[model samples]
Each structure stands twice: as structure tokens, then as C-alpha cells.
Target: MGEPLATKHDVFQAIADPTRRKLLKLLAEEEMPVTVISGHFPMSRTAVSKHLRILSEAGLVRERRVGRENRFRLDPQPLQEIKQWYAYFERFWENKMAALQYLVESDEPVKPEQ
Candidate 1:
């Protein structure tokens, strides 16, 4: 697959799950072992591992084997592509707001009533 298409798929997959999003937030703070991460949630360790696996496949997180534990860290570069995509819409909204402000100000007439 092409690079852009693959990156789009990765971002969609990464953001699809609330659990995964929470995991990403945790990893954003700092890399932590699976056990430590699992302690924050009520789900089983295996379920957390599955979420991590999906995130890893989506290129949102990276894992390393540290002795007997697996450590996961956020891979935020993929999110930069998502942010760049949103910036286009942000600019569009800004321009629309500017036009709306100009229209409202231009349409208002000064009141002469005492």
C-alpha cells in the first residue's frame, strides 16, 4: 500500500477504541510496563495486551521487552499526520468566522434613538 493511505488507516484504527485512546494518554505521560498500566483499569491483563497489540499494529505505540515485562511507549509521529490534516479544516473554519464577523458588523446600522 501507499504511504499516505497506510498512515490514514493507522490513524483511524488507533482512534477507534476508547480503551486504546486511554492507553495512548497513559503512554504519552511515560513508557510503562503492562502490569503498571493494567493497574489503572479494571480489565484483565490479556484485554489490555490486546489493546496494546492493536495500537502497536496501528503504529501508535511501540513495545519493548524489558526482562520479564513488556514496556509500551507512545509513538506520536503518526498523530502529527492527523494533526496536519485537521489544520486544513481549522483554517477553513477561521476564514468562515472572519466572513461572518464582517457580514454582521457591516449589516448593523447605528441606532439614533435617545
Candidate 2:
């Protein structure tokens, strides 16, 4: 009946930043503490941690405590939302490509755009 509740950090927003996207890729390989993650980027550990927090809020990353360290890892389940959103556009592009293919194969020519 009502609209879905908004999250503090949606997957779209979480992954909007290039830094956060890289963080996700890095975490995808394995869980790592802030110190290890910070080593990959030129930014400060606090900056990296901020990005991780966003990803965690989006459910795109999981954080766990190992000793005194906070380790982060990729949780790809949230990416399904992105995949589904893009899949609709994929179908649209596929239809356009198919139409272009038909036009190319037929006698009709595609005129150059001015």
C-alpha cells in the first residue's frame, strides 16, 4: 500500500563515488582491516573508513571485528538491486540493436545524423 522505506545509504548512493566502487572491488577479493584497505588508496584511513561505512549501510559490505581491528568484506547481495535496474535498460538496448541489425540487413540505409 505504501512506498518502500528509504535506506540511510542505498546501493546506488553507496556506489556512486569512485572511491567507494574501488573499495567494493578491493573488498571483493577478501576481508581486510582499515589499515590494509587504506594502503591501496592515497587517501587517509578515516576517508576509507567513511566509504566503508557507506557501503556497510547499503548492505553492500560486511564489517566484522577481528581482535582490535575492524575488517570489511564485500556482500554482493545488495548489488542485485543494481543488476535488476540495469537489466531493464539492457533489454531496451538489445531491442535497439536488433532493430539496427534488421535495418542494416535490409535494403534501407541508416542516414547520417546532422
Q: Using alpha carbons, what is the TM-score of model 2?
A: 0.81
Q: Tell me the lDDT of model 2 at 98.
A: 78
Q: State which candidate has the highest TM-score.
A: 2
**lDDT, model 1:** 0.80
13-114 per-residue lDDT for model 2 (tens digits)? 888999999999999999999999999999999988898888888888888998999999988887888999999998976787676543444567755533
Q: Which stretches of candidate 2 lie above 4 Å from their native place?
A: 1-6, 102-114
Give stretches of model 1 more than 4 Å off. 1-9, 102-114
**How close to the true structure is residue 15 of candidate 1, measured as C-alpha lDDT?**
82
- TM-scores, all candidates, are 0.75, 0.81
Per-residue alpha-carbon lDDT of model 1 for 56-102, expressed as tens digits? 87778888999998999998867877888899998876786575543
